[model samples]
Target chain A: MRIVVQEAPFDFAAEAQGFSRGLSGMGAVVTFSGLVRDDDGRLAAMEIEHYPGMTEKAIRAIAEEAQARWSLGDLLVIHRHGLLAPGETIMMVATAARHRAEAFEAAEFLMDYLKSRAPFWKKELTADGAEWVAAKDEDEAALDRW
Target chain B: MDVLYFAWVRERIGLPKERVETSAATVRELVDELRAREARYEAAFADLSALRVAVDQDLADFDAPLAGVRELAFFPPMTGG
Candidate 1:
């Protein structure tokens, strides 16, 4: 498993290809990428803040839980922290497994956990002003299914 | 112990982190001590329901003990993905 928490923007294509080729026995690979949305077309940038010591630890625990519950070959989670424009990528999760079901399910599980459990906080800067993005109730409720 | 704030809490408190010396046994008690320090702290911690706490870099409840905690953080609910 590979986990990265960085401020530099990652090359999505290269990372995705590297993850897929690194696995030896996996038959399926699933990837999810999150991007900052500018729904109103007024977003200036997003400032992400996280606890340096705790962010990696929390994500590692979540990834290990995914590995334990699913039969998988490997997984990768890359999250970015810092100021980013609306078009930039926020994070990505890639899961590889022997079958499609395990790969897809594990990817969804990781996404759900990352959405709420991680220590990262996002503040949206728009024309009006900067405001912290509130956590959605649906995001927390999504975890109950798993 | 080092007390940290993030997001709105940090903005409202006007600082990112500070060293705190407290005899409070739990997070709730520690908050009470902080609230008594200044009006800024009281305003920042006005609503516990909208806040989240982490003790020693781990997510913890407000009633969680702080016996050996070296770091404590307060922030709003995470909006990560």
Candidate 2:
């Protein structure tokens, strides 16, 4: 398992390729990337704030839980912090497993947990002003499905 | 113990982190002590429903004990992805 928390943008294609390569028994690989959305072109940028020490620990615990619940061969998580413009990549998650079911389920599980459990917060910037993004009830409800 | 705040909590409290010395037995009591310090803290902690707490970097409730905890954090519900 590999987890990265960085401020610089990552090369998603390269990272995905690297994660999928050299797999011995893994037959399926699932990858997901989150991008900043500019709704109606009002969004200027997104400022992300995170707790340094706790961010890594929280993600690791979530990843460990995914490993325990699924038959994943490997997993990769990369999340970005700091100011990001619209259409920029925010984060990505990948899971490799012996079968597609386990890989897909584990990936979804990781996303659900990361959305609510991670110690990162996002503030959206627009021409008018900046405002903190509120956590949606649906996002919290999504965890119950797992 | 070190007390940390994030997001609007930090903005409202006017600092990211601070070292706090207290004899509060629970997270709720610690919050009360902080709230008694200044209006900013009181305003930031006015709505408990909108806040979340972490003790020693792990998610916990307001009733969680702070006996041996060296780190405590308070913030709004995480908006990460």
Candidate 3:
């Protein structure tokens, strides 16, 4: 299990390459990427802020939980903090498991928990001004289902 | 007692961090004690509506005891993705 939380951009290709390094048995690698989206359909970019210690702990815990639930060989969760552009990637999750179901389900579970459970706050920069986005009820609902 | 503020909670508090000491028992008790300490704490904690509390490095509740907790953090609802 590998988890990295930093401000610099990440190389998805490199990460995918690393994920494919040790594959001896029949398996699948499920990957997911989260981007800065204009939820309000506003402008410029998104400013993401996070508590360094808490953010890492929360993400690591999520990864650990996923590993406990599945027989994963390699797991990588990369998250970026600070300012990010609209098209820029904010985070990525990769799960390597023996079967497609476990790999995909574990990746999705980690993403869902990270989005709603983790301690990251985002503010949208628009033509008008900047406003912090609230935790939507739908997000909470999504996690509750899982 | 270095009080660390984080995320939107720090933005609203207008200070990223501060330090203080008090004879509060639990996390909730410390909050009440801080609210009484000054106007800044009161304003910062004016609305516990959306606030989340953490003791040491673990996600704790307002009612969680802070007797031996080293670091205390306060923040708003998480928005991580």
Candidate 4:
């Protein structure tokens, strides 16, 4: 299991490639990527904020929970903070397993937890002003089904 | 005590960090103490609605004691993904 919380954007291809180590048991790899959205290029960017120490702890815990929920071989989770322009990579999760079922489920679970449980917050810089994004009810309810 | 702020809570208080010395035993008490200190803290913690606290990097409640917690974090609801 691996968890990373950094301000720098991640290279998904590299992360997936690196996850492929000397293990012979793994047969499948599943991944997901989230990108910053653009509204006709009207919105400039996003200023992401997070607790310095608590962010990593929260992420690691989520990854661990995902690991338990699935028979994942190796897990890679990376989330980016700091000012990010639209089209920038926001987050990525990769799961490896001996079969597709476990890898796919675990990858989705990681994203689910990342959506609501992680300690990061985002503010969007729009033409009007800076507005802090509120926690979405849909995101919270999505977790309940899990 | 090492006090940390996260997300919009930091922006509301205009403080990202502070080191305080207090005898408050629990996170809630510390918040009460802080609210008493200044208007900014009071406003930031005014509602405590949609707020969450963490002790030593662990998700905790406002009532959880600060017995062995080295750090306390306050912030609004999370928007992680």
Number of clashes in model 1? 0
The parts of candidate 1 lying over 4 Å away from their true place are: none
DockQ comparisons of all candidates to the true complex: 0.89, 0.94, 0.77, 0.79
Tens digit per residue, CA lDDT, model 4, A13-99 = 888788877657899989888888876677889988887767888898888888788888888888999999999999888889999
Give each model's clash number: 0, 0, 0, 0
Between candidates 2 and 4, the DockQ winner: 2
Top-lDDT structure, candidate number = 2
Task: Compare candidates 1 and 4 on DockQ and give the better one.
Answer: 1
| Per-residue lDDT of candidate 1, residues A5-109 (tens digit) | 999999999999999995888899999999999988999999999989889999999999999999889999999999999989999999999999999999999
lDDT of each: 0.95, 0.96, 0.83, 0.85
DockQ of 3: 0.77
Query: Tens digits of per-residue lDDT for model 3 on A27-140?
Result: 899888888886656768888888778788888889899889888878989989889988899999898888999999989889889987787888888999888888887877
- TM, every model: 0.98, 0.99, 0.92, 0.92
Query: Chain A TM-scores, all candidates?
Result: 0.98, 0.99, 0.93, 0.93
Query: Which residue runs of candidate 3 sit more than 4 Å off their true CA positions?
Result: A39-41
Provide the lDDT at B11 for model 4. Answer: 74
Residue A86 displacement (Å), model 3: 1.0
Any residue pairs clashing in model 2, and if so which?
none
In model 4, state the lDDT of residue A129. Answer: 85
- Clashes by residue pair, model 3: none
Compose the digit string of candidate 4's lDDT tens values, residues B10-71. Answer: 87789888898888998889999999999889889998767888888888888898886788
Q: Give candidate 4 misplaced runs (Cα > 4 Å).
A: A20-23
